[model samples]
Structure formats: C-alpha cells, structure tokens
Target: MPRPKRPGEAQDVGAFPPAEAGITVVDWIDERTSLSPGIRWMLFRKVPKGINWAYTLGSATLFAFLAQAVTGVFLAMYYRPDAAGGAYESIRYITDDAFLGQFVRGMHKWGASVMIILIFLHMARVFFYGAYKYPRELTWIIGVVLLILTLVMGFTGYLLPFDQRAYWATIVGVNINGTGPFVGPFLSDFLRAGPEFGATTLSRFYAIHMLLVPGAIGALIGAHLYLVSKLGITAPPWLKAEPEPELLEHSEV
Candidate 1:
C-alpha cells in the first residue's frame, strides 16, 4: 500500500526539475562567453518607481516591431519583388494559396500601422512627462531616428505590391523627395533608380525594406535598450522630486 501524505506535509509536484539543467547550460555558455555579468546587469537593474501605464507603450512598440519582422520574413519567402506585373499576382498567391499566409500577411500589414501608432504614443508620453530632458537627451534623439526609420520602412513596404495604388503613391513620394533642397534631386534619382520607377526601383525598395531599414532599426534598438538599462526608466513627473539614488550614480554630472 502507498503511504498517504501526513498533516502539514507538502506534496511534491516535480516542479523545476529542469532548473538545474538550465543552470548548467547557462553556466557552460557563461564560462565560454563571460555573458553572465552582462545578462545579470541587464535583467536585474532597477528602474524608477511610480511608473504608470504610459511606460508600457515603448515595450508594446518593440513587440509590434518584432512581430512585424517575423511576419515580414515569412512574407518574403513567397513575395516576388519584380517591377513587372508579377508582384500583385505574387501577393494574391500568397494570400490565397500558401498556408496561413493570409494571416501572416495581414499581421505584417496591420503590425506596421500598430508599430507606428505605438511609437508616436511612446514619444508623446516621454515628451509630456519630460523624460527627454537632462541625462536622457541621447535616448530621445535615438528614438527620433528610430521613428524616422520606422516611417521609411512603412513607405518602402507600401510600394512592394506594385499595384496601381503603390505605383502612384511611389511616384508621388519620389516627386515629393525631389522637391527637397540640396540632396533632393539626388535622393529622388536614387530612389527611382533613374528618372522614374522601374525594375531597379522595386529592387532598391526591396533591399531597403527587407535589409537596410531593418538592420538600422535593429542596431538603434540595441543602443536604445542599452541606454535604457544604463540610465534607468525616467521617473514620472508627479513622483518624488529627487531622482532615485541609483539613477544619480549612473547619470552624467
């Protein structure tokens, strides 16, 4: 007969059995790479108190971007970027034939809009709360650059379908770029791959959308996160007048 649990005795559920295994793997990698310290610093760092729901916008924006990146990669697998009439048809095939392609494509499309809105909201929150002042100026600047890159990502992706709407919108966009000052003509020429949109333009947009913009955004995100970790999240204005002690220790004097 099996022994029953006694009073006040705890039942073992075999929870966390893999915890030791996970630690072993982490230690093995940490030994080779010396990554534990950095990881701990990043994960265990403290931030300002009294942060409210507005603080979540930045993380939400990051999540939207990551989702867009994943969905974009899946989309690229079947997307044909040729300027010839195939681009629209390729999109149709993906939406109609590929498994779950419609859902992924829809997510990528809507995710871009969500990311843009969230980023704007985040910037507004920071600006209104005065987080852009003082020691966080560089962070704000990087965030602005990130915002610009994100907009450019949207613009570039807009033309990938190569439909009438995309063609006309890109034409208008190129013309608008040409209206700028010193580098305007050069910029327009580069974007159109000559005087007007063609196969080269499609290729260029694809390269920018899929490679250059994402790479730039990724680098800026890394820098942004590093600064956030180092500077700590800004305290809400209504909080205590004095900054946190740890924040003062890390701030520029």
Candidate 2:
C-alpha cells in the first residue's frame, strides 16, 4: 500500500490542512472500528424538551467522581497502609513535607464529600423528574448500588490514615455493620481489632478501599450509564404532556 515518494515531496504523512486533520484522523479510526456512531449516539442523542441545568446533575456527579479518582491515584503514591505508626507518619509526611501533597490530599479529602453530595443531588433530580419509571427502573437501582459502594469507599478509605479518629470511627462503623443478621458477628470480628492487631485490619480496609470497592463501583457505573443511554432521558415532571399533532383531527382535509 505504499506509494513511492517523489523528490521534493513532504515526508510528513499526516500533514493535511489543519481544518481537515481532525476529521481525517477520526475517519481513519472510525473506518477501522466503526466507533464513531456509537460515541455519537451515546453523547449527542436527543433529550426531552424540558432539559435544563438540573438534567446535568448526573454529569456533574460523574465529574466529581473523576476528580476523586485522579486525586486518589496521586495520594496513593505516598500513602502507607501500615498500622504501626507508619500509616499516620506517611500521612503526616504528605501533609507537611511532600511537594503539593497537602493540596492533593485535601482535594481527595474534600472531593469525597463533594462526590457524595453530587450523587445524592443527582438521585434527587432523577426521583423528582420521574426518570426512574418503567424500563429505567434498573438504571435507578444500579445508581442506588453505586451510592452504597461510594459510601463504602469513603468509609474504608477513612481508616487508611490509621489516626485515632479513623480508628475509633472504623470501630463504630464496623459495629454498625456487624448488626447484619447472620453474618453480623463474623463481619464485626473481621473489621474490629485491638491496637496491636490493627495491621491486618488496616490492610483489609486498604485493599477494599483502593481495589475491591472501587472496581465494583466502576463496573456498576458503566452499567448505569449504559442503561441511561439505552433508555434515554425523560421529560421533567413539570413539563405538560402535549398531544401529538398527528393525533389531531382536521376539520377539512
């Protein structure tokens, strides 16, 4: 498929005019995988007539999640899950010594709260707008699952610093979880540990926080988005339903 280059020809293969370059690249990829249509359908599809800022809550919540994920990755670089003072010292070092570590940690710290707030707001919007009806019920259920997982993510991550507050908070939280009927005692025992035995507890929380829960949340989010896209958006409840013109009878035809 190679054409012999003639003398004086430019060697740059993608040196098309700037205006066409983006389209050309897109076309190349689209031809190979037929990916463009799916993307366009997912992103640019029609919405109900009452679409407004409220409809954007899902996107806002998604942005907050992305922010948390990015900052969390950076924080993970300096975080230590050691319960033998190493964990607290690592956090102290980040807060006081590492370059911009405090800022990243702060973002992750505050961003968790922000994400929780946004998801709730998004849930409220869906509920009030009546977007959870019919075929969309599964999407709403998946969203509820995501909300629970997000809370678990926050709870598990809160224990990673191995601070006194985190330690006590986790103990209380585990006690709360341990109230589940059959598995209650086992779960409580799994999470509750003495100061000398806290290493295993810290490790378990760290793994669940950074690996298991996040992975589950990510997968559920994917399913939620897919369902949303497939089911499409519903009109806000305040919007009056209009009779279709096709259904109107003409006086004279």
Candidate 3:
C-alpha cells in the first residue's frame, strides 16, 4: 500500500496552491485564446531611460476613469430616469435609505470632477512632454475625443438628481449648446429629445450617461492604450533625441 500523506501535504494529486492554481487557470485561457504573448507585449515593455513620474499622469487618469465606472454602476442600481418626480425621489432614497448609498453617490458625484481634472492634467503632461507628435498624433486626437466624451458624461450625469438646480442648469446647458452656430440648435434639440425637455428627455440622458458614452469611452481607451503600448513612450522633453546618421558622420569628420 502507498504510505499515507502528511497533514501538510495536499490530499490529491490535482490539488494546487492558490498561486499555482491561478497560474494554471491563466495558462489554460492563454492557450485557448493565444493571449499570453499579446498581454506580455502590452504590459512588459522596454521603455526609454529617464522616464519620470509625470508620465504616470496617463495612468492616473485611467484609474480615475475606472473608479468612475465602478461608482457609476453602483449608483445605477438605485437610480431612476423619471423626469417627473421619481428621479429626485430615487436620489433621495439612495441618500437616506439604501445601505452606503450616500457614500457611493458621493463617490460618483465628486469622482466626476476628479476624473475631469486628471484627464486635463494628463493631456497637459502629454503636450508639455512633446509626446503628442508624429506616431502619437492619433493617440492625442483620441485623447481629445475622450476628453469631450468625459465632459458629456459629466453633463448628462449632472441632471440625474432632477432637482430644481439640475433642471434649470440643464435648461441653461441645452441653450448654450444651441448657440453652437449652425448645428447648435439642432444638436440641442436632439439632446432635449425635441423642442423641449419632453417625457423621454431624462430617460434619453440616462441611457446616454450609463450606456452610450461609457461604451464609447471604453472602446477608445482600449485603442489609446494599444497605441501607447505599441509605439512606446517618448522620453522627457528635456532629454536630447538620438542624432541623425548624417549629423554623426559630419561631426566625426
């Protein structure tokens, strides 16, 4: 007969420690999807020397987005898009009734402001660092689009409470959008879902806030990150670039 295993030993041959089991699961999925190499390529990058903390502003902005997404989902569980009275009451319920409702709502609220700030700071970093040139120009454009979408998300989310201030503020916002020259009036009308904030206006904005804009933002973020990983990061602006071959030869001569 085989000897009995010790107490510390695994009871079965298939048994694995948590770390080993995690690796096994990852390997299994990677084998099926052929994703390991892609993941390694994206994550395990060989970057230029002298990379500074300022470069991390992009990552900070990304995390801010993630935080917003999480907190937004939590808020969505309790939010109602009713424009009449249900919307404001739902918000009141979240603030006064639901478990940790106020806390999560606060996160989603204040987090929007934080996300906007982070993205601007990130854009500034990219601009001042001279990383917005040539190969990275598309990335810069995408970032600009994301910035606009973020602003839209903030705008749409602001009206969810359906309070007196929100109602009037949104009216003011739509009017301002109407002043966008030729297309401005049409665009604002579309947003208000007609000539005025009709029955479906809040619902429309809610769908946009929770679904449309977030989906677009996620897709763009994926593309942005892929470009960043593939093209690699630029060195700090103060750092000298490699000299051209002709210049090197001329200098040697």
Candidate 4:
C-alpha cells in the first residue's frame, strides 16, 4: 500500500460512477429544459393542516384508474374487437396463452370497480364536509362529470367480451337508451349502429372504451387537479371559525 492516506484523502474512482453520472445528466437536462421548477412546484405544494384520512380517497381513485389504463392497454394488444364471435375466443387465448394476461385482465376489471367505489366515497367525503360549497362548486361539478365518464367507461367496456351476458346486457342497455323520448331512437341507433348489435357496435364500444372515455377522463382529471392546486385542499369544518395565518413572505431575488 502507498503511504497511509490522510483522513479526507480521495479514494480511487470506479469506471462508472452512477450517482454522479445521474446528477450530471439531470443537471444538463434541467439547464436546457427548465423542468425542475415546475416539477418542484407540483411535488412540494403545501396542503392545509387539517387534512386527514378522508382526503386520501381521491388519490386512491386516481391510482386505481392508472392501474386500469395500464392493464387495459396490455389487454387491448391481444383483444379482437371487430369480430363478435372471435371476442370470447380471443379472451380465452389471452387467459391461456399470453404471459401475465389473466393477471392484467383481472386487475383491469377489479380496478374499475375499485375506482368507482373510491370516487363515490371521495364525493361523499367532500359532500359531508361541505367542501363542495362556495368556491369549490366548479370542482364538484367537474368531479360529477368525471364520475359519469367513469361509469360510461365501465358500461362500454362491459361488452368487449362479447359473451352471452355481455350481449344481452348490451341489448338491454341499447333498448334503455332508445326509451329517452325525443333522442331515444337516435341514441339507440348510434350505440347499436343499427337495430341490432353488430361489428360496428363492437368497434364503437371498443373505441369509446379505449380512446374516448379515457381521453375525456384524463382531460377532466388534469382540470380537476389544477383547480385543486389553485384552491387548495378545503379545511375541515372545525377549522372554519379559527383565523388563518398570514401568507409567508418571500425575499426578492
């Protein structure tokens, strides 16, 4: 060994220094893209002091929706939508042949149900706490629209298997749509693509399930999140009577 090294002496460096290399890459990207500030603002935003377990339902719902989207994408890769007769067989093949197919499909199915329940619970929490009053009315309205979209997403996806239950349930749903007085026939025809379900109907439901509903949900969620950031989390009822603290002042750069 060389002469005893000093306590703070530099050690031999490895050929690849992962930590330093990562920081350097991040610094390079941040310098050029200016992304760090926005990311920090989103990640480090302040919340009200009284936030409790009830506030977590919305985040849970979002997580469940993300799971559904991911699993749905994987399922879509092997799904056959154009052929009604082939739909069940395709699902069977996915369950039997594809890697992790059944697991992903099960997650998507259960995730939809869980998301619905969480969304309802979130709405209930907000409603019970009177968080929907006054400044948050628009937020509540957007949330209701999101809830409807989620329900529609489930309805459209229910028929993808093209099995007996799906077929009959869709028939009933289309018929129910047709009972809407003035727009009933048009709505029914649009959904079924004719008097009866066909290839067009399957294709329509698939498009709505995979693209239209998901896209709408994503846009609404973005708007909802922006509104939440702007308005901040609503304080609990008990905190309403207390005076709030003054905003913290920042020094000029």
Candidate 5:
C-alpha cells in the first residue's frame, strides 16, 4: 500500500518524470512479460491452433501492393504520359530503350489484378467468419476504403500506357463522371483538367496515377494496418478450444 505523506515528509517519486512515465511503464511491462525463443507473447494469449485459408489473403494483398509499388516506380522512370503522339514513342522507348521495362510493366499490371482478387477474398473470409463484429467494425470500414483505393489505382493506371485503349477508356470514364447528379460535372471537369481530353487530361491523369493516388492509398493502408494491430486478429466464430488428450490421461493417472 502507498503511504499517506506526513506534513513534512518527502513524497514518494516515480522512477521517472511524468513526461518520461513511459520508461516506468516499460519497466512494469518488462516484469510481467517474457520472451520465448525470440518471440514476445502477450499475457493471457493462447495461440490459435487452427485457422482457415481466408486468413492468408490479407498477407497476399499486402505482397501484391508492394509488388505494384516497386514496378510502378520503375515504369515511371521511363514513362511519358502525353496526349500528343509522343505517348506511343515514349512507351516504345520504355520497351526498347529501358532495361527490363516490359517485365516491370507486366508485373505492375498483373500485380494490381492480384491485389484486387486478394482483397476480395479477404473480405469474403471476414464476412463468412463474422470477423467484422463488435470491436472489428472499424477494420471492416478501413477495408472498404482500401477496396475503393484499389479500384482508383486501376483507373489511374489505365491511362499510363497512353494507347488507343487508354484514350477511349479515359473518354468513357470522364463521360460517366460528367453524368453525375450534382457535382458530377465539376468532378469530371476537375479530373480531366479540361472540357475535352487533350494535353491537360494526360498531365492530370499522370500526376494522379503516379503521385496523388499512390499517396492516398499509402495513407489509408497505414491506417488500416495500425487499426488491425490495435484490434488483434479475429479467429473464426465457430472455433472452440480443444483439450490435449495426452495431458488429460496424465492428469487421470
């Protein structure tokens, strides 16, 4: 028990200052926890013995995202997004002039698709297992945001190649946006950077695809990961603890 101080008695002080209270906190935490073969185990935690394959999709999505980021950086080094005829020429340079350009672009495109598939699979797992319950509501919300970002990434990337397919895709995309209810026209105009697809549109898409979209995705992913860490992984709802038969036999003896 802590003592009540007398009139002139010195008050007991914590080992560290209030602002440095974390040091004291660490000291207390260290006393209560121990490492097992280089891994720290939280008190009262029991490692789950069985988990479904759905749990792995989140990891796959993360890997895909990383792959896309790396390949995108490499492609950006040689890509020139222009409404001018130089678009095809620049891409040709990337293919013919830059080292490993074809492989990088292929990897980026394929990686984006893989990310989409993995995210969907992860979401399905969460739904089926009811992992999106109680304390995990925020994680699900962030997952939705991440899904939207993945789509945005796909849309932004569609224009980078600057081919006939890209040109028509942006045209259809802007037209769809232009049909908005209230601020749709404004958003479309803002997105395209002009009334019609031209040099401005190419510049806008390039900036967004290369910098802005990736930045937004990065921020959201960071938040999602932080929340997941805070909430901890949710095991399947149907899961039950199993007793060890060997231990039970020994206890009976």
Candidate 6:
C-alpha cells in the first residue's frame, strides 16, 4: 500500500484541489493578461516624450464620450420619450423634480459637441504625424467608422426630445430615406417604425440613442484600442534614424 503523504507534500497524480480552494478562470485570465504590470503595456510604449497637447485630445475625447453616456443614462431615468406630454412635460420634470437634471442634459448636449470637435482634432494629429501608415492602418479605418457612428449617434440623439426640431428633422430624414431606390420606403418604415414619426418613432430613437449607439461605440472603441496595442505606436521618421550623437559626430568628421 502507498504511504500517506505529509502535510506539505504534493498531491498524487490525478488528484485535484478542493473545489472552493481551486483557482478560478478569472484568476487564470488575470495571471495571463494583467494590465497592472506597468505603463509599458497599458500605454506610453514607444510614445515620444515630446508628445504635445494635441496628442492628448484622443484621451480627452474618450473621456468626454464616457461622461456623455453616463449623463445620458441619468437623464433617461427622468425623461419620457413619447408624444404624450413628452416634449415639454419631460423637460419640466427634468428641470424641476430631478436634481441636476438640467445640468446633466446641458452637459450631455455640450459634451457631444465637444467630443465631435476633439475627435476631429485627434484624427488630424494622427494624420499629420503619419500615424496611420502600414501597421496602424486598421486602427485608422476603425477610427473612420467610429466617426461615422458618432455622427449617427448625434443625429439620433437630436430626435429624442419630440419637439418641433425633432419632428421636422426626422421628417426630412425619413424623406431622404424614402428617396433611395428599391427599399427606400422599407428603410423608412424600419427606421420610423411606421409611415411617419410618432410616439413609436420617439421611443425608437430613444432606444437607439441610449442603447444601440452607445453599445456600438463601445465595441468600436475596443477594436480601435486593440489594434493600437497590436501595432504599437509608430516612431516619427526622424526618430527612426541613427542616434543624434552618432549623426552629429559623423557630420563633423
């Protein structure tokens, strides 16, 4: 018969740890992909020390987008996106009963505008830096797609209040959709959820603005960040040359 093992001895083959004591799948994942390692993996890898204020816009834009999403969630709790006293009464409740509702709404509105501007600035910085070349091409393409989605989110958000502006804007939008060949009417029906804008239309836009668009934005951001990590930062052309001291000495000699 096999001898009994000591307290600190290793278990025999085919033995397993107790269920409650065993490591979890999450533990395995954390061990393999811990971002806590340092800044090198999280960010700042290969990024130049001279990165100017313009390079900061991407992070600022992302922060603004997150702030808008959180504020919109709060606003959604108090605002009714329907035709039954929705446009004016909802505004009254937000401005009256809901503490900081007006501020939240105002912040979301202005943040959207700021996010748009910052994203453009960020894109311009990347473009001028030639950051879209070769290995970073997919990130650039995803950024373009994200830009289109951002505009869509803004347009969809503009229709949520059910006011005259929302009504006429959606009407024009529906008309444009209805003008397309073949499935134009179908597309309009799908978007409007009927022949024209109504209570249902308001609810649909609210859903898209609050849920669908944000979800897509989140997914695109993930893809963009993943591509950036995969490619790493591209060094400037000048930085890619021999060291400054070597070049200087060679020129002097």
Q: After superposition, how far is residue 103 of candidate 6 from its true place, in Å?
A: 0.9
Sort order, lDDT high to low? 3, 1, 4, 2, 6, 5
* Local accuracy of candidate 5 as per-residue lDDT tens digits, 1-253: 4477799988887643576577667767766774332233322344365676778888788889889888888787777776777777888887777787777777887888889998999999989888899998988998898898788888878887788898899789888978989998888889888776767788787788778878888898878776666667776777786678987887855
lDDT of 2 by residue, 1-253 (tens): 3366789986666644687778879899899999978888899988889789988889898888889889888888999888878999999999999999999999999989999999999999998888899989999999999999999998998888788899988888887887899988787777655433355889888888888888898898889888888889998888898877776665343
Kindly provide the TM-score of model 4 when superposed on the true structure, using C-alpha atoms. 0.87
Tens digits of per-residue lDDT, candidate 3, 1-253, equal 3357998976665554566778888889988999988889998999987898888889998998999999988888899898889999999999999999999998888888889998999998998888999989999999999999999998898888999989999999999999999999999989999999899989999999999999999999999999999899998878888877988987945
Cα error, residue 102 of model 6, in Å, equals 1.3
Ranking by TM-score, best first? 3, 2, 4, 1, 6, 5
- Candidate 4 lDDT over residue span 1-253, tens digit each: 2355578987655444676788889999999999999778766888877889999899899899899998999898999986547888998888888988888888988888899999999999999989898898999999999999999998999999888888899899889889999999999989988877776899899999999999999999999988887787787877755443443244332
- Each model's TM-score? 0.86, 0.88, 0.89, 0.87, 0.75, 0.77
Q: Once model 6 is optimally superposed onto the true structure by TM-score, how far is the C-alpha of residue 9 displaced, in angstroms?
A: 23
The TM-score obtained by model 6 is 0.77
Candidate 1 runs further than 4 Å off: 1-19, 242-253
TM-score of 2: 0.88
Model 1 over residues 45-137: C-alpha lDDT tens digits?
A: 887779889999989999999999999998999998877778899998988999998999999988889999999999999999999988999
Q: What is the C-alpha lDDT of each candidate?
A: 0.91, 0.86, 0.91, 0.87, 0.79, 0.80
List runs of model 6 lying over 4 Å from the truth: 1-35, 38-40, 236-240, 243-253
Residue clash pairs of candidate 3: none
Question: Per-residue lDDT of 1-253 in model 6, one digit per residue for the tens?
Answer: 3358889988674454466334556567668887445445657566655456776777898898899889988887788876776656787778777888878888988899999999999898899889898878889998998898898888888887667787799889878979999999999998888876656877888788888989999999988877777677665444554467857877855
What's the true lDDT of residue 74 in model 5? 79
Off by over 4 Å in 4: 1-16, 244-253
Model 3 has an lDDT value of 0.91
